[model samples]
Target: MTYKEFMDSQTQLEAPAHLTPLLEALWYAGRDEWHRAHDIAQDNEHDPMHNWLHAFLHRQEGDFGNAAYWYRRANRTVYSGGLREEWQEMVRTQLPA
Candidate 1:
């Protein structure tokens, strides 16, 4: 899906079925469903991308220390951008052109 389509999906009651688990977490995050997003991210622990999403969720929750830990797990630097910008970056990176 395109980034715009992904963003627009936030208005719907459910995430698009084609989305990966990380994208589903992002979808929930866009809807301000932090716990749901966190749960999805946490459950998909086999990927660094999931760790990245977990870090983003923790950062959004104002849990900097936990965010740092997840960022380390993801092998990523702590994000310095605004949460929305970081979220958009994450979504855009995962979306098809």
Candidate 2:
């Protein structure tokens, strides 16, 4: 199903503790809703996970510089897991191409 549909299905249920808003934003990202994803993640000012999400959003928008900046903020070795494999593959492919 579409990501927004997936997210809509999950809305009322309690999200896992470390993944509340993150998962919500992830759904938006999967749907290619960059602004919606950004809105969901915006409150997490200093969170590494939020920074990572920002990186992913920027990457999807073809803003490598901002993506890199957020990646640095998150201090991650790679952006994987949580995200769908197809989306992750897109990001992986974009790394050098």
Candidate 3:
């Protein structure tokens, strides 16, 4: 499903079916459940996207140092924007066609 669709469907009792692990984590993040989001994100490959999301999670939790490390892993410059904007940017970048 498209990202807009995903966002729109988020009011449901369940997450969308057959999402990638990252999308599932994003879904949980959308649900405002950070621990669940991190649980899924932690198991993902230690690649850029995972690192990026992990960084976002840590940053969300206000752990700047740990977030910096993960941001390094993701090769992304440290973000100085609001979390909601950053989250939407993540969704835009990672969103499926």
For candidate 3, give the lDDT: 0.86
Root-mean-square deviation of candidate 2 = 8.4
How high is the lDDT of residue 88 in model 1? 89
The candidates, ranked best first by TM-score, are 1, 3, 2
lDDT of 2 by residue, 13-78 (tens): 433244457666765676667797898767784888777888778777778788788889889645
Q: What is the descending lDDT order?
A: 1, 3, 2
Error of 2 at 20 (Å): 1.1
Candidate 3 lDDT tens digits, 16-86: 89988888888888778899999888887476887888999999999999999999989999999999888
Query: Which regions of candidate 2 fall more than 4 Å away from where they truly are?
Result: 1-19, 77-97
The residue-level lDDT of candidate 2 at 93 comes to: 31
- Model 3 sits at a Cα RMSD from the real structure of 1.3
Candidate 2 matches the true fold with a TM-score of 0.61
Highest lDDT scorer? 1
Which regions of candidate 1 deviate over 4 angstroms? none
lDDT of 1 by residue, 1-97 (tens): 8988888888999889978889999999988899999999999877999999999999999999999999999999999999999998889889875
Tell me how candidate 1 scores on lDDT: 0.92
